[model samples]
Target: MSIAELQLPPSALHGKKRVLTSAFVGTTVEWYDFYLYGTAAALIFNTQFFPAGSDVAGTLGAFATFAVGFLARPAGGIIAGHLGDRIGRKSLLVVSLITMGAASTAIGLLPNYATIGVFAVIGLVLLRLLQGLACGAEWGGSALLSVEHAPSRLRGFFGSFTQVGSAAGMLLATGSFAVAQALTTDEQFQAFGWRLPFLASAVLVVVGIYIRLGVEDAPAFRKLKVENRIAKAPVWEVLRYHKRALLVTIGLRLAQPALFAILAIYLINYLAARRDDTTSGVTAVLIGSAVGLASGPLWGWASDKWGRRNIALVAIAGIGLFIWPFFWFLDNGPLALLPIAMLLGMNILHDAIYGPQAAWFAEQFPVHVRYTGVSLGCQIGTVLSGGLTPVIAASLLLAGNNTPWLICAYISGLAVLSFIAALAAKDPVGDRLRDSDAHDEFEVAP
Candidate 1:
């Protein structure tokens, strides 16, 4: 069908810009909440929450809590996907934002290990789990909200607003930490300055919720409701009938999330361990995320022009080729080169995949189960890669005598997996506007 033929009613399309803005703002807030924990885990969680060990052991302990959030994500994805598929995307987006903001703000109020003993650690883990669940639920709904509301030809560009939110979140996250560090003495920063970012999430969440409430659900979903075509068991339907779509989505997702966890989270501590300075790493990430915020939409536009799978393959290849040099710049190059490494690794390579991913994954499943399928696939990949990569990389660093060769090899292996999966994916942008119930199964490569 031609793009014009598939356009929704003028009323349904009237809020397209508003929907995109809400998706971006909601996700930015959600990610800001999520990344706050990661930045803290890297910089101070060990001393504040798990204070009883040697530096390496304490770092490991802190990262384990970081991974705990990943462990809860699939549950969040499953619940959100099921409810989103049955109810509507807008409501879930709103709920995820509220839950994330509350959990993050609560973390700011949590007592430290010295003050409350092991309960402080226990409380931190519980709140982190909530953050993970909220994050898990947030992405699919946000992505679909943008893609489904967009005209077929502009889906990539619109869907990219969701990805851009992640970059923006990271930028806000790193910037908040940098500013906090600058404003406080080391002892004061360790004691109280770290809580400021988490507390700030409360304000952002209110803004996000207001914007989301003002917008309507996607027209595609409204049509599904009008026609009574919502899936009775979306999670089951996806698992039983769309296994290939699930596999392909997971595969295509592996590299970027893992690479991001490494560069944005783990590397902060790694660089700090080497130079005893966290500021430079945070600054590099801040610059890289700014670059990513600009690059994300362009990459999404490229996917619209060039094809999603093709752009994804090129990005996967770039990650594979750049892993070694990314580390080289951090380890051997001058201080000036740190931001360049972050820019190339994060904005250039990672955003290339992330920008195209929402529309591509959404296209892989029928709308009836799009939320469930994308959430399950994407979150599973996250748990396996991004969630665990920091812990695994840390262990490997210790084993390799602090060399990054093992981590480099690990990321390269995932890149190859993603490339093969991207090759198997069928670009279905042309058919995205089709009626969801008419095509219940994905059109996969034979």
Candidate 2:
């Protein structure tokens, strides 16, 4: 049961296509459920779930509930990471999928504020928390499953499938909303059309659950079990011994998630106020996410060719430089510029960083504690950035008379921080991942 005795046979690695499909499909479903709430919050929840109030107040209330899911994410990551590191990744994936599906479907069925008073809002928040937890648990397991099951040299390319799932999920969410809007009038959409997307998650979840169950656990985890090297207290070990890796993971994670929040969530409200139509913004985002779906694996393949840090640094720099022009296109340019701005910001810039993120973050830790390290770091960073970006950007917009300069500066600052973090982290792509043992002290490569 020693590490050297457990060299993975070719047959053990043969099911990579199945593993990648499982990861991509399952993560897509999870993110679809999670992001549906964000879209709904932007388009309908403000009025549907909260008391009658100013437009800004209602947006803040709905976004506040959206943020609640993020707050619950870290707890989910911690719990799932701990158990996933000990037990297995497949089971956690299945459980998180079911949890998110149930929560989203319930949201579809729940009564509105006008019908049930404050109880409606409370129910919304509670269901959002469940969605958050499910989302938190989903990424680490899915990413690791794909990365660990693939050949080491192709880990970056294969791992990007999970990132593609995110883009696909956003596309699905935006497309679903767009179709619902197209089919229903404004009055009809507000009344019932918004619920269709949430309710539809039930069917996707069944598919995701079945696919996930068919896939085996990662080869690395299986090796860990054969060797009996699983860490007894993975969370505590990550906190005590792997603080720098955790910090690096969090730092590298900041700008991308924040950028995504701005593009995917805040922009909907921002553009709606200007055009007086929400569909335009949703259409723009849908187009951007579609491009993003194609770009993710390309960037990931580029990372495998170049280095993860090299591609990440270039992408982060692109984000910093693109912030000003992004708003310029949105604010001063013609209506057609909206989709172009989204394309440059989301598909090109944000996705370049996200494409290699799964492999890069997983590389930061050894197998025994990787689940906890990557999940905790990723979820914490997400909570700090993605969870708050929309609310903060909305406040900045309102305070600055709908100006975007403050928001631009905010994103630029995060990009700068992330660039420094990526520069500092080591690229261990040429190193053998399995050789990094559980007994060794956590040492980030120089």
Candidate 3:
């Protein structure tokens, strides 16, 4: 081989690292901004800004605000996909980071129910919607930045970094809440300590934007541009041609967000309602998230070797079997077992699906419209699962007098549905995404 060819491989490998790291940090910032609200909503928002009535009503209100973010995610995804496909991934990622961080910081500054009454609630909902839109745009861009920049052989390993950001962000958000709680009395925490986590997102956003600005668009996207392969209305193109793949992606995605909502967000409320506290659940989740953050890349690497379909299928099944055991550990715990169940739920069972999702989802569409196709499908799933999950779990608990069996069944049903969808969808392991036949036929708009 020529010396030029030898030099080419190492240079390309180094570039992939730069792109993947930018994607990782930017995604981490977005998720940190997003998950902080989930924690705040569960821990304090209901009492702070919502229409006050009962604890249940307040929680429902807080979570309804949470759902509003998910409601706006599709629009964000559609807009980002359109722009990112034509303009570039790096720019949109920076825009998304700033937008998400600013919204979160504004939430930290907003007045609450005691000061402004219903206007406080309205402001909170609007900010939450803004957060949703920014986040919806963020997920696909960051994930694609990593996956598209990566070599096909290592796409899962590289793509996994975006998933790592999710777990890391959850870890950061949960750990911050734990620290804030420890530093303050319950009343002080409820009054003002909660804002610290939201405020911290500004620092993350700054770092994310700096890093993202240093990177270029992925190789595939650049190639698409060079070939004049950009789609004019990519969302409509996906809807007309690749709708089945989009639907399957949505179905497979439902379980992960629902599981996260139940175990991460709802469990805080569950523990609070059951024992009048969230500290243990927070502690367990903090530990679980840290473990998952570390393990995501390993799972991503494994997906490259083991196949995304096989790994997802097994993990979903594992999640089903572990559901009752998970709650049992929380319910009958000697306290030490609490983290074990959470570790299994978040790090092991959940990461199996999440770690490879970036590569898996990206592979479903062609380079010309990949961002729009993947973003639309994944954000729709988020709206369905993440938005309403805590509300559904909370309602079930209220109906069953706090019995968790019914709630567990609801989550298990989603897992089963997810498994079936994965079974039906094609695995794109080593599939050259740039060569998608489905998109090759569509001519670029004039």
Indicate which candidate wins on lDDT: 1
Off by over 4 Å in 2: 1-14, 430-446
Q: Per TM-score, what order, best first? A: 1, 2, 3
Better of 1 and 3 by lDDT: 1
Look at candidate 1 and tell me the lDDT of residue 217.
77
TM-scores for candidates 1 onward, in order: 0.93, 0.93, 0.92
What C-alpha lDDT does candidate 1 achieve relative to the native structure? 0.87
Question: Over the stretch 309-333, how does candidate 2's per-residue lDDT look in tens digits?
Answer: 8778888988888888877777767
| Candidate models: Cα lDDT each | 0.87, 0.85, 0.83
For model 3 the TM-score comes to: 0.92
What value does the lDDT take at residue 139 in candidate 2? Answer: 95
Error in Å for residue 37 of model 3: 0.5
